[model samples]
Target: MFSYRHAFHAGNHADVLKHTILVHVLDYFNRKDAPYWVIDTHAGAGIYDLRSEWATKRGEFADGLDRLLAAQAMPDAIERYLQAVQHFNPDGVANFYPGSPWLALQAMRGRDRLRLFEMHPTEIEVLRDNLKREAAGTQRQVAVYQADGFNGLKSQLPPAPRRGIVLIDPSYEDKRDYRHTVQALSEGLKRFATGCFIVWYPLVQRREVADLQRALTRLATPWLHATLSVSKPAATGLGLHGSGMFVVNPPWTLHDALATTLPWLKATLAQDDRANFTLARHGD
Candidate 1:
C-alpha cells in the first residue's frame, strides 16, 4: 500500500531486531574478505530523522532505539549495532537512524556492493538521492530500483561476487506479499542456493504470520528464527507486539550470539509484563 510510509515507523522495535541481526550476518560475510553483495528488497529511505514531523507523530523510537541507548553491558552483538547507530548520530544525540542498506554499507568492505529495491516511488526518489550523496555514486557502490522488490530482486541473484545476502522486508500492507515473499526465496534459491536470505516479519494477531513461517520451514534449508515480543498483544487485537527475523544460511556464530543477547533485548525493550523472546533453529 502506498500509504505505508516507513518514515513514521522508522526506528521502532521492529527495526531494532531487523538491523541488529542484519549487522551480524553482514559481519560474518566480511570476515572472509571475498567481496560479497548485499541485496535489500523493500529498502526504504536510506536514513531517517527521528525528530522529523512524521517520526514525531509516531514516537516509535522512544520505545525502540531510545531504550537501548542508555543500556549498559549489552552483549557484544548489540553493542556493535549501537556503535553503528552512533556513527550517524555523532553528537551523542539519538536523532538519526540507518535503514538496512545504510547498515550494510557500514559493515561492508570496499569491494562489497549493494543492490537496493523499493516499490514506493517517493521513497525510491529519496533512496536514490541518499545513495548518490551518502552512499557514493551509482554504478559504483549502490544500485537503486523503483520496483517491486519481490520481482526485481531475482535479476540480482548469484551476484557478481557469487556471495550475497538477500534481505526481504515488505510492508505486509498487502497479504499477497506473504505469498510473494516465499515465492521470491524459492526462485532465488534455485539460482543461488547458498546465498544468505533474511526475512523480517511483524508479530501480530494474524494467521498469515504463522503460515509464512510454515512455508519457510518447508524450504528445508539450514536456518535460524528469532523473535522479540515487547508486550502482550493489545486488547483490541491490533498493532505490532514485536518482530522477528528468519535467517536462511545464517552465520554459524549467530545463534550463539543471539542466545546470549536476545534475553537482554526482550527485557530491555519490553513495554509490559508480557515481554519475552523465542529462538529456534536447526542445521547449524
Candidate 2:
C-alpha cells in the first residue's frame, strides 16, 4: 500500500480530469454562503515538484497538463481549472503541481474547513510540511492524519457544517480497494446523504476497474460520470490509458460543464485515434 506514490503520476491525464472536476465542484460550493467541509481521502503529498526525480521519471505531465497549457480554445471549466494550477506555478513556470489537498486549500475560504487523510508514512509527513509552508495560518482549519482514509472517513462524515464534499481516490494497488471504495461510499452516505461525493479511478485493462465503474453508477443516487481515454491500451496492459470521475449529488451544472470540457480534453490529450470521452448523468 505504501508503495504507491502520486509523485510518479501527478499532473498526468487522470489528474487533469480529476482535478478539473474538483475545481468546478469547489467553485460550486463557494457559490453558497454556507461554509462547507472538504474531505480528502487518500491524500498524497500535498504538492509535487514536476522537476523532481519522481515526476521526471515518468514525465507524465508532458502529455497531460502540458498539452492543455499549450492548447487553444479551452472551455470555461477547463480554463478555470488551469488557472487554479497556475496558482502554484506563480513564476509562470509549470514546475509545481498541487494535489487534491493543496487545490482544496487553495479554493477554500477561511470559513471553510479541510480534512485530509493519508496512509503512506512518508507521504503523510510530506503532506504536513507542504501544507505548513504553502498554507500558513491554516492549522486551525485543516487537519491531517496518518491513517487509512477508507476506514477513517466515517468519523468525519456529516461534518460540523452539515455540508461537505468527500473525495475518495485511492491508488487501487490493492485489489480490495474496489470493494472498499464501494463499501466506504455506501457507509458514508448513511452518515451524510446529501454530501457531495467524488470518486476517481484509473482506466486500466483490469476487470476490477470496469466492475468498480459499474458499481458506482448503480448506486441509485443523482450522479454525473465522465471518462477520458487518452490512448490505446497497451498490449502488455501495464499502464493507465485514461481515468474517470463519478460525482454523487453533483451540482446541476456539472454535467454541462464536463460535456463541453471532455471533448476538448480528448483532442488535447489524445495519444492516438483511440482517444475518446464519455459523459452521463442521472439527475435534473
Candidate 3:
C-alpha cells in the first residue's frame, strides 16, 4: 500500500520505542574506532513538522514526544535519545520532530556511513530535501534510495567495516511485508552474522504480527525483545495499542539499560490498567 505516510504518526509511541532502541544501537557502534554503517530500510522523510495539517489532524505526538518532553529525571538511555532530538530544536520549541533518518544522522559520526531507502515518491523527495538542508549541502555522508529496502539491502550486508546495524521496519501495509522482513534479516545474518539488527513492529491485532514474532524467535542468536503497551486492544481492533523492538546481537549494556527504562516509560505513558511493559532476552 502506497498510502502509509509516516508524517501523520511521526513521534508517536512507536517512534519513542523504536528510536530509543535505535539511538542505543547507534551509540554502541560509535564506541568502536572502526567505522560502521547504518542501513535504515524504511527511512521516512528525515523530518516532520508537528504543526503541519497532517500531523495536527491526528495529534499523535501529543501522547508521545510531547509527554516525554514534559517529563524530567529520565533514565540515561531515555535521556540520551531525547537529547539527540534536542539537537534539531536548539530554539527550545517542539514545533518539529525528527524522523528515524534524522535521528540516525545526528547520532552517526562523519566517518560512519548511512544508506537510507524510501520507496514512496513524496517521501524520497522530502527525504532528499531534508538531508540536503540539514546536511547544509554536504549530503554525501548519507545515501538515499527510492527503492524497495528488502532487495536493495542485500548488497550492503557484510559491510566493508564488517560492523553495522540494519534497521528494518516497514509499514506492513501489505501482508507480504511481514514475510519479507524476516527473509531479509535471515539472509542478512547469513552474510553478516555479528552485525546488530533492530526491527520495529506495531502492536496491532493481527495474526501476521504474531507469525512474524514467532518466526523471529526461531533465529538462533542472542537477542533482546522489549515492548511497551500504552493501552488495551482497541475495542474495534483498529488502532496501534503500542509497539515493540526486537534486537539481535544487541549491546550488553543495552538490555540492562532498557530494563530500567521500560517501567518508567510505561508509568509515564500509560493510558489505563491495560498499559504494561515487557523486557525479555535469550542467550545473554
lDDT of 1 at 5: 85
Off by over 4 Å in 3: none
Top-down TM-score ranking: 2, 3, 1
Tens digits of per-residue lDDT, candidate 2, 179-244, equal 999999999999999999999998998999989987988988898899999999999988999998
Would you give me the overall lDDT of model 1?
0.89
Q: What TM-score would every model get versus the actual structure?
A: 0.97, 0.98, 0.98
lDDT (Cα, tens digit) per residue for candidate 3, span 1-284: 68999989988888999988888888888888888888999998889998999898899988999899999778898899898888888998978888877877887777788899999998899888888777674476788889999999998888888888999999988889999999999999999999999988888999998999899888899999999999999899889999989999999998889989999999888888999999888887
Clash number for every model?
0, 0, 0
Backbone clash total for model 3 is 0
Top-TM-score structure, candidate number: 2
Q: Which prediction has more favorable TM-score, 1 or 3?
A: 3
RMSD per candidate (Å) reads 1.2, 0.8, 1.0
Q: Note the Cα lDDT for every prediction shown.
A: 0.89, 0.92, 0.89
Summing lDDT over every window of 10 consecutive residues in candidate 2, give the lowest-scoring window. Answer: 126-135
